[model samples]
Target: MATVTKPEGTIATTRKAEAEGDQLVTMRGIDWQGYLTILDMKTDRRFPRVVFLDGEVSFMSPSPTHEFLNDRLRSFLRAVLSGLGIPFLPLGSTTFRREERRGGVEGGQTYYLVNRGHVRDKKRIDLSVDPPPDLAVEIVVTHPADDTLEVYRRLRVPEVWVCTETELVFLVLDRNGHYARTDSSVALPGISAAEIHSWITRGGYDDEGAWDHDLRRWIAEVLSPRLRETTR
Candidate 1:
């Protein structure tokens, strides 16, 4: 049950879906200014995540299960990166928008690993001047109305991980400026979607200390060695 007030003079066609406490509403023909107006109005609240693409806007209210999965994935990723000793800046649910491209999105868990140095000192990210996040993660408990991947593509985000109740997908932006599915992450080097999926599933029910211990051990004894050899 999420609501958005339509901006004046915009031809808005609405579509809504609700399941398991998740709600999505898509409005077509919303101008860029209208999108900004909506975002400005909702500055105080965090729910009803919004995305805009080519005059269309989608507002999504994530369910409890959706948020639970998001937290699990974030924790798993942080552990992996920490165990690997990679310096990364995590920007949770940051809204990225490029007015020129007419695209904008709020990432579930965005990270800056390769470009961490470039933006580390900055307080805000302006997509027109700043580099896009190296990696963006999306948790899909309920499907959004717009093509969010396309929005990321337009934003030129290098890598995107899409996680669901049963699947995890890795998409790397290729030279052709399109996202292509890959097994291993280009940003995280040796980490694979399958490995992350396995960890996320296990971490959901396992004790936190036990899960962290096992994951750290695996990274130290197995993944770390593999990465070192590859670099050599």
Candidate 2:
């Protein structure tokens, strides 16, 4: 396979376009090692997420709306987990790479549940030695060249939630090591993708703080029985 690496500082040049909307750049021939080098270079700046699959690399700079939904959904997920009394560790946009699989990805919000406590204190995750997150959240106002679902599949991610302005796509990895679109999350039982969409895209909230307050109230009353009992 050909190896092509993007020169440093390319991401900095896209600020103008990023100001208008999301900017995406896809490059080919970058090996796994090259991906790691670029990742280290941008360790401190994580806005433009980098994805690596085989020799293809994609850098995605999310738009303001994308960021808004990303953060909103992230906060909502945490509220749901906490209300349900489930322990979780939020690893937002953490680059997870495995050279052996020649796959790497950074979700808008990624999280570990079953193994959250195990790696709670660690600062970095080595997928070669550590377990991958149970679920990854991807917000797609625009799509990219490389298939993120394919990347997640190759990385053996258990579940992925792909959200758009109009739709929420739920995917679960099957026993065959492939992702299949589903109606509900297998990782987050009783939570359908549509339900999450309804909550996230609810209208008439004057501000995010108000929305969050209403969301938490709804989650307590309608989503979690234990939370409802405690509140009552």
Candidate 3:
């Protein structure tokens, strides 16, 4: 269930469930300046990830399970990319925003793959002049009332991987600038969403090191040859 409140003349909605353990709060009528102020205040503490779409802002506090899933997925991605000999730059939970587009979001785990070299040497990313990450990940334990996909669309991110408790979904930005569900990852060629989901489920209860070793083994013995053939 969700609770709606009016604070300081702004309409705010908060959602919390004991089973989910994730909390989401949404506030309406927040101007760009207000959003920036809130972001600045929370700069030191990265929890309660923030997103702004138009005049509405959402703050999400992820749970232990959510973060565990996020960490495992990130490790899996890194292992796959390293096994494939792909050069990638990992930028974890960086805030991406553009005022002109009136949208912004803090990614859970983002990576620059094909466009790795574009912002490789930069200390910071200015969306005004920089290309958005090639791959962005989102772990959604609780359904967001805000339109997060719209913010990603405005940022022109090439690909997004959304993970829920049950499944992982791959969304690729198409020619028409809309995200379409895809069977395989555009950023990491030959990787399928269903395969990734299976790996996550398999590794969920195992020892971390042992699970990772098995994942690497699969990549080396099974995925590596397939990728090599595609390149050739």
Q: Lowest lDDT 10-mer window, candidate 2?
A: 10-19
RMSD of each: 3.4, 5.2, 4.4
Instruction: List residue ranges in candidate 3 displaced over 4 A.
Output: 1-19, 203-206
Expressed as tens digits, the lDDT of each residue in 157-227 for candidate 2 is: 89999888887888899899988889878767777788898888788987889999988898878888744
Question: What's the C-alpha lDDT at position 81 in model 3?
Answer: 87
> Which clashing pairs does model 1 show?
none
Comparing 2 and 3 on lDDT, the stronger one: 3
Model 1 is weakest, by summed lDDT over 10 consecutive residues, at 1-10
- What tens-digit string does per-residue lDDT give for candidate 3 at 89-160? 999989999999999998888999877788998988998888999999988886552377889899999899
Could you arrange the candidates by TM-score from highest to lowest?
Answer: 3, 1, 2
* Runs of candidate 2 exceeding 4 Å displacement: 1-20, 226-232
Model 1 ranges off by over 4 Å: 1-10, 43-45, 203-206
TM-score per prediction, in order, is 0.88, 0.85, 0.89
